[model samples]
Target: MVRKFYPEEFKADAVELYSSTPGATIKKIAADLGVHEGTLSAWLRAAGVTTVPTAAGRADGGGAGVPETPAEELERLRVENKRLRADKSLLETEREILRKAAKYFAGETTW
Candidate 1:
């Protein structure tokens, strides 16, 4: 006789296990969970999680629900990166000004 596991519970556990411990072997996990490795893999696939051989923008192939062109993503990332960089610089300058003001009032270096 064989026992059946709930689909939702199995999928939830799979995601939790994978996220908590990355690079976990499917066979070991399946054995621990009392299911076949292939079954666990299928569950992961159906849960919209998959492992890709290459990083984003490097390979032509992408995971499900991703845009095709690397250039499109690259430009978007570049814009966001520039914006964040500018924001960081501005914050650093503001911090320096505050530090100088503190020092001036405390009778530190005048320059």
Candidate 2:
């Protein structure tokens, strides 16, 4: 595979993006920036940024060492709750579609 070189400014921007964005993961940011997660992590480490371990057991650039203020925690939870609600709505829609399909198929049976 061919190796790609990035400019110093780009590396700095990537590190800064990881450091500044709350709830942002290195994997997500790297995928957005079209770079590998490991490359983003290296850039973060080179810039002296600390990463937090995610529940999936992977290190995410979410600024783990720093404690969040109560307001910050509340905002984070609010964002997560919104995302989960959206996911639940999507799953319910899918389940309803599947249920309709099953009913339609059951009525069309040859027996």
Candidate 3:
């Protein structure tokens, strides 16, 4: 991976995001910015952005951060489910392609 650099203004905007957005976490915003959560967290502290931790805060396994609202959670699950199904579809397609390729190589496939 290449070392990344971010503009100070961008960092300031990101730091302010946590305070401005309800239920928004550092990890979530960082992922949206294509940066690491830890890097964003450090920026937050350096900028003196005080964040109040909620008891429900957690890191998302596949997404960004844990959803705070019921609607948010539902949306997150729906997105993840869609992504998983798409991945499954791709894998199935790839398997079919490989199976056909194998038959062709073995002289068992008809045009």
Candidate 4:
């Protein structure tokens, strides 16, 4: 395997991008920049950038150092709520299809 070298400016920019983008994961940002996640993490560490830890004891990219205003928080919640509802709807449909399949297969069985 060949090792690749990135310029100092590019590394700085990548770190900045990670810090500036809200809700952006290191994995996602690294993929976008065509670099390995570990490379990006190293850049972050070299730049002395620390991620904020969430209540779940995991580092989160959201709310880097600034707290969201009430309106921003509300908007974020609304978007999350919408996504969750869509997920729930899809799961319900899948469950119904599975239930129908099970019923059909059960009826077809004979001993």
TM-scores, each model vs. reference: 0.39, 0.55, 0.47, 0.50
Which is the winner by lDDT between candidate 2 and candidate 3?
Answer: 2
Off by over 4 Å in 4: 53-111
Residues 1-111, candidate 3, lDDT per residue (tens digit)? 898889999988888776676555666788888888889878888988765444345432244444378765666566557757878999999999999998889896458
Question: How does each model score on lDDT?
Answer: 0.62, 0.78, 0.71, 0.76
lDDT of 2: 0.78
- Indicate the residue-level lDDT of 91 in model 1: 100
Better of 2 and 4 by TM-score: 2
- The sequence of per-residue lDDT tens digits that candidate 1 reaches over residues 3-100 is 66667876798767854543345665677787776677777777776542223322212344554367765655665577578789999999999999
* Candidate 4 TM-score, true structure as reference: 0.50
Which model is ahead, 3 or 4, in terms of lDDT? 4
**lDDT: the better of candidates 1 and 4:** 4
- Candidate 4 lDDT at 15 equals 92
Give residue 83's lDDT in candidate 1 (0 to 100).
Answer: 58
Task: Enumerate residue pairs that collide in model 1.
Answer: none
Query: What C-alpha lDDT does candidate 1 achieve relative to the native structure?
Result: 0.62
- Number of the candidate with higher TM-score, 3 or 4: 4
RMSD of 4: 8.1
